[model samples]
Target: MKRNLREKTKRNIGLDLTRIFAFLSVISVHFFLNTGFYKIPLRGKRMFILATLRTSFMVCVPLFLLLTGYLVSAKKIPLEIGNLKKYYKKIIPVLLSYGIGMTVIFAIYRLRGDRSYNLQKLVFGILGYKEYSWYVNMYIGLFLLSPFLTNIWASIGDKKTHLALIAVFSLLTVGPTVFNVNDLTSLKAIFAAYDDNKINHLLPGWWYNIYPLTYFFLGAYLRTYVDFKKLRPAKVFLALILIIFASSAYNIWRSHGGSFQIRLWNSWGSLQNTASSICVFILINTLAPERVNEKIERFLAYISKLTFAAYILSALSDKLVYSFVNANLGSVKESMPYLPIIILSSATLALAMAAGVEFLTEKILEKSVREK
Candidate 1:
């Protein structure tokens, strides 16, 4: 019994550390995106440095989905109203924080004499729509669809079918996305006939965006069936190194010539990105220790509480933070010397702001509910 308890504690520590890594990676990705670090007019050494870091963190979103699947599957709970209620109980507080943050941001935008508010923007912000929290929206969709998803998983009961499903999703989402083949004659003509309005074009775009669900399923399947802990560590490490190298090489090669937008879109959906993400997920899971000291465990727990808040609030305030950084840093050379410092400072600032906003908002909401 004592041995079992020790093993379980170790597993929990591993899981917590992965969540923390995923949280930090997401922030790092946003830092690059908002600051336009990748698009900086740099060459040779500077560009190489930026590209390496960018490639390293490309696994952020996939890691998130995989972790989500791993935890949800471990629950082995019935996907009923209670599950959803529990989800919303957690989600709504986060959304409320996001809403409060956005209000302040929009007010700042207004104060800056920028009156570009539109109906679409309003709806997106108010409804927590598919603008910034795209992942959150996708996860919510999965939550709503969990019953059917789990039932299908149980019914299939084979690895081949799971692989087949993954392949189909990849073809639909990753294939067209990476290859930039959505505008092909076949696809265009099909979409032209299907919708004169051209809303979805030829293929159903929603099906392609179901990549998160694919990751969720893949993560759950691996956790349930794969004894990754028993795998040869040397081989797993080699495979991970190869995957990262290939993915980074492919990204560098593909950066030859394109507008930044085109490059960004393709890189995010590339096959190499998928391979790298899965590799990182497995690497993190397999290498996570079965034990950690109390100090580390407590630190992980504290930061994990702020992950969702950090994501939403940072995203909402990215533009402002970017502007502030650009104003202070001025040029690449000036900022390059202390780039790590800048990133750490900005991330810390974001975390502090997110925590404050969440705490105050939660109190206000709770007080209002109590009074009513």
Candidate 2:
């Protein structure tokens, strides 16, 4: 029993460390995206460096979703409503965090003499449209639907279906968009029709982004069906580095010629981003340490619990930080040499504050839950 307990502790440490790193990666992504990183010209190695960071961090959210799918698969969560209710209850913390964050944001804007807030926008914000937490809604849907999805995954019982679905999803979404290989002008019309025909109204706007669902299925499929023993860690690491370099360099090359929208697409959601994300996700899962010092494990576990709060706080605070940086440090273009340091510092500060608040709030909330 003692040996078994140690093994469990060891196994959990990997997952905890993964979450902690992914959370910090996401904070870094938000800082760069919300700031003037994009506004800087693609002139030298600086823009290329930014591209690498962006492409790498783009995997952060997908990594979390993949982790979610892996746990669900590994645990063999039952295809039952009761299990879902337990999952649903887990989201209360997310809702509370969003509410608190948004209220703080609203207060900041009002105090800054910005009166753009209104009833309609508030409703939209609560529903997670036109905001950072839009992924939360899609996540909830994926959580509720996971049992059914994983059921389908089980029924297929083959790698062929997995490859087929991934291919199709890639074709429709990331592949062509990244490479500009296909004439997507007509595809835009299809989406435009979907929008105008009120098809979007059939579900929340957030649900329309199908990447999350694909990622959810991919996660389950990989964890349940694939054998990583054959794949060497060195090869996987090499692949990861290659994808990051190629993707970042490709985007930099595109920026010299592509239109603004085209450049943005290539930089942000290109094939490189998706491929790198997959590599990193697989790399972490396959190669992470099974155990660590007890102190380190405890620290990771605590920080991992605050992942959602860190994400929410960073999202809310990014704009304020950007504003402050612009006002104090001049335009990001002028601070190009120091941009990375500034952005990283802001993300770290936000993560620290978020973790502190989440720690205290969770204690209070869990106490209430226990009392009830």
Candidate 3:
């Protein structure tokens, strides 16, 4: 019993590592995007390294969704009124924190003469609008639809149901990319518009619905069907190879004509990104070795627990950091060389601030909640 318990703990720890890595990847992406780091020319090797990091980090969002599906689905947390209540209790704080935090950031920006607001932007931001906020919105939708989605999984059973759902999801994922009709309402077009206009688009409201439902169902299906015990070393290697080749090929193709927009469209698809995420998932599950997995798992568990706080604080930090740097250093376009340093410094500072805030919230604020 002792040995078995130790082994189980080890495995959970390994899973946590992968999760932390995913979050770090997210941080890296945001760092690059908000800063102009990727634009720098670092001769040949450095340029190649930065490019690889940028491309690989793109998997962060999909990996996050996949993990969400895996965890929630595997736990088989039944969706009920009680569950909904609990979910709202958990999510409401995040939404409220994000709103108040962003509002302050926006107000500061406006004061600095960064006038990019209108009624639409204000409405959307209040409603958790903007690109980075999509995950929050998506999760909210998932929580709201959890009962229906879980029921669908429960009714369908494992094999037939997951397969059927994947098939439908595949169509939903790919259909928008291939066909475009202005008169018709395409999921792809909506997602695209959201990407282009951020809060300015009405279509994001629709696309946000797809994130949680699709991911929740996918997670539930995977939890029901995928058997880590059945996996072998050879199969794991093959999956890894496939993920590498596919991701590399796709990245290369994307380099020619792809942009963030294309990647966003392909995010929901079970193509390279999905394959990569699953491969990492499988690799972590079966062959993570013991020590490495334990370390990663512990770190990720910490980060995952604090992810909501990190996200909220990170956004606020990014805006503030960006505004401060831009103001002090002049326009980023002109201060290109200093951009990377500023972004990195700002991210570090933001992460530290987030950690501090989380400590207070959990220890002090949460204690107050318990007392109440």
Candidate 4:
């Protein structure tokens, strides 16, 4: 048992790093959002550098989506009635965590002087949209469908067909978004004539929002078929570096050093976003050492488990840190040089506070659950 546990740890340490970095990316992305990075005009070499960080960090959520699909694919959960209860039970803790996080965010909002929120508002907020927890809505839909999706994955025995499915999904979800005039900042759209009405109707993008499934299915496909053992880690790393630059460079050119929208198409379906994500996801899974240090493994694993909570809890960190910084540290542009410090401070504070809440939440969840 010990040998098996150690082996699992070695293999998963890379994923642990993935989770940890992904969570950090979430915090960093919020740094841009909360620090007024988006409200200011983006241009010049400095903005390009910041854009690169934004591009790189944007892959965090995609990495998690891919990880979900990959991990789910590795398990053989059929869509049978017998397996339904066991599979669905995994969601109890997620729901509980979200509830706790949501209440905290709503409470903080009230304390921030939004007195319009009452118990009724809080109750409505549970079923409705809450801050920093949009991912929860997307995830719940994906989670409910995973069993059927994985079963569909199992049915597709042909590699060619699987690739074709991914291509189609990408084309519909990512292709139009990356090339349409409706979104002028996209690479192809940036080069072409700018016309909001001149959309590429040939490639209908009505289905672009299904990108969560795209990432999920791609994750499962990579896990099920790709032979990462055969690929050179150096080559993959080089490709990832190039993709990040290509992505950031395009955004820089489009911005023209003024009136640029950094968050536009920064969604999961962006080409650079998708490209960076797949590349990093592949590299991480491929390049991990066979035997990681046990202590490092434990640390990585512990922090990784708290990632979701840290992420949910960042609603508070973002509020508190930025509130203080915006008040004392000067304007967002003026504080550009100190971006690293600001983000680090917020992330550290969030993770520290989330650690205790997460532990207690887990214990409560454990007791609340009754085995059949």
Candidate 5:
């Protein structure tokens, strides 16, 4: 029993490494996309390559959702009420942190003579309204639904039944847009309006949420029903490779045909996001040499602890670093060859700053609670 427990703990650690790497992939993709690095000469091809890489990492969000389902749905049919309450407490800090970070960014933008501030926009963004905040909104929505979803998972006895449900949801997610169904126009229109002309309403809300919860449930289902211990590592690696190739080819084809819309196709399907996530998962789980994996695991764990801080600081770091670099070096185009160096430096500075802020926040919280 002790041995079994130890093995389980190791597996969990491995999983955490997977999650952290996925998050890093997300950061890298966003950094490149937002910095206009993709627009560099011959960068389109490079972007395509990165997109392929990104798709593999796209699986990361789903992996996280899967972790949520497994953790939340442990025991009983339809969920235990106690678990719901517990998760609510757990998610509060995440929401609050994201809120505080968003406010900081908003204030900075406003102070920089950007001149755009509205209560509704602020509230909406806080609620995961537009841009990257959508992930937060999706997470909040999933947390709210977890109890019911957990219940559904508990009651379903057969694997086929759960898989069938997933298929139905995926179809509901992809069908209307794929076929361009006019009847569903109202549904699309409603979401568009609700998201304030943003693409939030499409695909059962889960897809707009990047289907993280759906993937989470799927992972939990597999964990509960399947005995993956008997599976060969090579098989898993091969399967991941195949999936990456297929997803990349499909994305490239779609992109070339001009049939791709950023919100619907690129963002939703995100071939790179999906592929990179798969590759990372498989590599971490299988091909990574023992010593290498241990080092990586440690590094990823450190980064994961600082991920929220890094995200918040990235915005500020971008502004500060860009200003400094511009002041010293003139146009980015002229300094094109040093772009990678700039990104690396900026990211390092941001990570350090974020870590400092997080450490201070934790110390303050500890003191406040002690006083209370």
Candidate 6:
């Protein structure tokens, strides 16, 4: 019954697996994006199947938020200058990670002779955080606020109070997102006045942008409370599948057999995406052993560290893998049978490149520090 998670030095194999899977899910989503999965018409079972896969992998970003809450919520950040310094020291590597990632990615594009990123765009793009670095931008804010968020969660008087907070946050963030409609024209024939952003008219959409906080509080809740043994993992797995299928089916139906648009529950704040990430996070922690082989944990620990860099550098792998595949196959539909392999190839390359980049960056930083 340790109250301080920092004191618990042993690794949670479940979290390691979660981190790796989340990074893979990120890469997998790009597989869909680069291959034009969205352009495929929702005709027959193929779109449904592919959409279902896409829906399942859509847990990418939320998983990281939940992981952040679980790992950081129990931190003991006191009101002291030393504590603040220690706190920020942890964030510097992440900042460095993004910097290295953005620079490396920008350089790769420049080297490849991509005219889109000229000298001016390169400076502005990296300074503005670039397109694929949106998650990094979001995470930097969260990381900065996590200490205060931890204080709020830790100050709660009781489990009931924490549950109430979770409920209210859910209403403000998840409710609006899950209940909203993206396409107004499709509904205009029926509702006449319906347009974008009307479905959650009563739910208060002002706070919907803070959905990451909802998942964060959720992870904090699970970390501080919740008995994993009591909740059946089998039931959870079934619910995960059901939610994925239901969400995917809703998108198919909403699309009206047109281009497979992610119209329903495909967002970070959507209920289905939130629930799926939670379910997988819970199942892994509950099912995985308390400890793993030392050798394997060491390997996974290294890989887990690289997952962030791998994610940031994923566009490099995506371009390399998809460019070749698409040139050969002509379309995503024609390459349906090789979807899994293509995804694996892309993910593998990202990890491989991340290993090199992370190692080289570490050595470079170490050398700079030594010189200083």
Candidates in order have lDDT scores of 0.65, 0.65, 0.58, 0.79, 0.57, 0.81
Descending-lDDT candidate ranking: 6, 4, 1, 2, 3, 5
Best-first order by TM-score? 6, 4, 2, 1, 5, 3
lDDT of 3 at 43: 40
Q: Give a tens-digit lDDT track for model 6, residues 1-372.
A: 573653387787878988988998998888778888778787877667877888889898999999999989978887577887789777766777777777777788888998786768867876787758888888888887888888899889899999999999999888876555544345464333333554445467788888889989999988888667667889989988888888888767666777766543467888889888888888877787776777998888889989998888887888888889999986767777898898889888888878877887788779878999
| Model 2: residue 254 alpha-carbon error in angstroms | 2.4
Candidate 1 or 4, higher lDDT?
A: 4
> Where in model 1 is the C-alpha error above 4 Å?
1-11, 38-42, 77-90, 104-124, 128-131, 177-206, 232-234, 257-267, 316-321, 331-334, 360-372
Scored by lDDT, the top model is 6
In the range 350-371, model 3's lDDT, one tens digit per residue, is 5666566566555655776789
* 276 Cα displacement, candidate 3 (Å): 1.5
| Candidate 4: tens digits of C-alpha lDDT, residues 212-322 | 889988999888887776778899999999988887777666665554455335567778788889888878778866566778777778888878878888988888888
Taking all chains together, each candidate's TM-score versus the true structure is: 0.76, 0.78, 0.67, 0.89, 0.68, 0.90
Model 1 alpha-carbon miss at residue 79, Å: 5.4
Of 1 and 2, the candidate ranking higher by TM-score:
2
Please report how far candidate 4 places residue 349 from its true position, in Å: 1.9
Candidate 5 regions off by >4 Å? 1-11, 37-51, 54-57, 75-83, 103-131, 174-210, 226-229, 257-263, 269-283, 286-300, 318-347, 364-372
Better of 3 and 6 by lDDT: 6
Q: Report RMSD for candidate 6.
A: 3.6
Candidate 6 clashing pairs, residues 3+ apart or interchain: none
Compare candidates 2 and 4 on lDDT and give the better one: 4
Q: 1 or 5: which has the higher lDDT? A: 1
